[model samples]
Target: MRLRALLTTAALLAASACGATPDAPAKTTLTWWDHYDSGAADQAVTALIARYQGAHPDVEVKRTAIPPAEFRAKLDQAAASGAFPDVVAVDSPDLPRLVAQNAVADLTDRFQGWAVGEALLEPVRESARHGGRFYGVPLRSETLALVYDREVLAGAAPPRTWDDLRATAKALTRDGRAGLCFAGLPEEDLTSTFLAFLWQAGGDLDTVDDEAGVEALAFVDELVNVDRSVPAAALGWDNAQVAREFAAGRCAMMVNGPRVVQVLNQAGMNWSVTALPSGAGGSASPLGGETWVIGKGSRHADAAWELLKSLAENRDNITEFGAGLGALPNRGDTVQDLAWQWDPNVAAFAAQMPEARPRNGYGTKYPQVSEAVWTMVQQVLKGDREPEEAAAEARAKIEPLLRER
Candidate 1:
C-alpha cells in the first residue's frame, strides 16, 4: 500500500509534465517505451519510429528505451500508478502479469481486421494472447539450438538422441575442455533452456514431478556428476558466459539462443547449429521474444494500435527489423525470406519456430514458478539434492502458484 501511494504521487508529477496548456501543440503524441537499449535492435526501433512519423505527419511518437535489467521493475511501477506509456514493447514471458493486472488493452477485435494477423507463427501468436483474447502483437521470436564446433567434433555428425548426445559429449570432454555448456543459474534463461529438456522428456511444468521429469533430471545428473562431461561451474553461468566459454574454446558445444551468433562471428570461430537432440518424448524448444502492447490507460489507444500495425503489417518493414533484431520474423509469410533460409548461423533456430512452445500456458504466476524450477535445476546439478527429491519439492511449490493465478 505504501509503495502504491508513492507510485501514485510519482504518476501525478509525470502527468503534470505532459499536461496541455493554451500554447501546447494540438498534434497527437504517443509516448512509447521499450528495452532495446543497444546494438542493431535499438537502431531498428529508432528507424521504425522515424519511418512511422514520416508517413503520419500529424502523429508523433516519443520513445524511451530502458535498460533491460531495470525494464520490468519500471513497468510494474508504471502499472501500479496507472501511468503506463501509450505503447510498450514487452517480453513475451512477462505479458501475463500485466494482463492479469488489467494494464493492457484488449486487441482481439482490432487483430481480426488486421490483414496479416493470421500469418503469425502459432507459438508467437499464442504468446501474445490471454484468456483466448489478443492483448499484444508479437514483433520478433527465437528459440534454443545446439551449436557445435566443427573441428572439435572431428567430422562426426551432430548427436540425434539421448544416448548419442551423452556419448558424443563424453568423447568431446577432454584436454581440460568440457563437452557441453548451457546457462544454469537461477534466471529466465535457465528456466527457458531447461524447459526444452523437460518437454523432450515428455514432462511439462504441470507434471514436473512425474516419471518423465525424473528421467530428465537424472540425465542432467549423469552429465554433470557421473560422466563429468558438463562442468560444475555451469551452475553459475548465464547464457552470455556460456557463449564466452564456447568462443574461448573452453567448451565444444552449447545450447543457446540466436543472439550468440554475433558473439561467435566476432570471435571468428568455426561453428554450425542444429536442433537439440530428442529424448523419449521427441523434440521440443521454448519460444522467446518481445510483443507490442497498448496501455489500457492510454488516451490514444486507436493511434497506438495504428503504429503497431504499421510496424508489423508491411513485409519490407517486418523483414528489416527482424534481421536487425537477430531473430526470426513472426509472420509465416516473411519467416522464410531468402537470407534467413540460406544462412547457416540462424537456419536451425528458424526451423524450430513452428514447434516452439510458449510459456503463456503457465498462467500469470509464471515468474514464481520459474524461480522454483531454476532453483531445483541448480540444486540437482550441484549434487546438493537427488533429482527425484528436488523435482518433487519444486512441484509442490509450483502447483499452488498456478492455481492462485
Candidate 2:
C-alpha cells in the first residue's frame, strides 16, 4: 500500500469533487506522470516528491517522466489498457480534449473553492476550462516577450509599437548581426508568434482572412523580405533555434519566453526582457502552460487531489517550482511576490500575463486551425504568395475544419 488514511473531511470533499469513493484503495502507491525529467525543473519535481512523501509517510509516490513527443501516445496506451496514473500533467490546450473524452476527473467546484484559486490569473484559469467546467489546475504558465541585448542596442530604447519595432529592427541591423529574429517553423511555433501580431491587429484566429490579419502578415513579411532585418533562415527555425541565435549575438532582439534567460545567462550574454511591441490595437500575446489533472478511474483519486492541492496552493512551492521549470507563476500573489518583482528576467512575463490569451481561442481540434495559420505564415515568408493571398488560402483550408471540429 502506497497511499492511505484519508480523513472524513477529505473523503467527503473528494466524493463531492470527483465522486471518489470513501473506501480506501487496496493499493497505496500512487503514480504521478509528467513530461519533464531533465535539468533544474525535473530536480524540483524530485524534491517536491520527496517533500510530499515525507509529510505523508503512508502515501508512496512513484514518479515517471517521459519526453513530450512520446507523452500523448504513452498516455493513450495507458488509457486503453486501464493503466492510467493517479495524476498526470498535460498542456492547458489538451485539457479540453481530455475532458471531452472523460479521461480526467472534473475539479470545477473543488478548484474554485481551493485557497489558491482566489489569486489565480484570469488567463491561467481560462486555460483550464472546457465546456464550462474546470478539469485541471495550472502547474506552470508562460508567455512570449521581447528579449533584447541592452549593450547591443547601443543605448536605443526598446520599441513599443509595430512601426517602432520595424524601424528598430532595421536600424539595429549591422556588422553581420540581424536586428531581429523569431521562429518561423511551419507549426505551433509559427502560429503563436503570428497570433500575437494577429490579435494586436484586432483580428482573431477565426478571422485570419480578414484585413487585419493580412496587415499583420504583411508586417512580418516586410521585416523578412523588404527590410531584410530578420534572417531568411528563420523560415526553417523553431523557438529553440531562434533563442540560440539571439544568445549568440546573431540577432539583437528575439521574441521569446522567460526560459531564454537560462540559455542567455549560461552563454554569458547580457539581455533584458520586455513586452513585445503591439500592433494598432494594443498589447497581445499567446499564453502557454501545463496543468495538473487527475486521471479517470484512478483508485487514488482523493490522494492525488490532496497532493495536487498541496503543491499548487503553497506560494513557496509553486514559485520555486516554476523557477526551476522555466514557468512563470500563474497567480497574482506569486507574480506580485517580492522575489518576482525584483527579478528582471521574469518581471516582463508577469506584467504580460494580464494581456496574454490562449492560442487559437482554446477550441477543440486546434491543430488543424493552427495548420492554416502555419500555412499562411510560411507562404508569405517564402515569398511564394502575398499575405492576402496566403490568408485567403488558409481560410479556405480552415473553413471545413471549423465545421468538422
- TM-score for all predictions? 0.90, 0.89
User: Per-residue lDDT for 1-405 in model 2, tens only?
Assistant: 224445766777877898665567554688999988688768888888888788888789999999877887787787777677889988776666666556888888787657687678888888877777787888788999998999988778899999999999999999779999999989778888998888999887666889898999999999999999998999989888998999888999999887676788888888888898988878899998788889888888889888888888655676456567777867877776665542467777778987689742446667678878898899999989998889989888777666643
Q: Which stretches of candidate 1 lie over 4 Å from their true place?
A: 1-25, 318-320, 339-342
Candidate 2 Cα errors over 4 Å, as ranges: 1-27, 80-82, 403-405
Per-residue lDDT over 1-405 for candidate 1, one digit per residue giving the tens place of the 0 to 100 score: 999999999987887888834464577899999998888788888888888899888899999999999999999999999999999999887888999888999999998857678888889889999889999988778889899999999899999888888999999999779999889888988899889999999998877999999999999889888998889888889998999999999899899988787788889999999999999999999998888899999999999988888887655565346556767755677666664542466667788888999997788898899999999988998888999999999999999988855
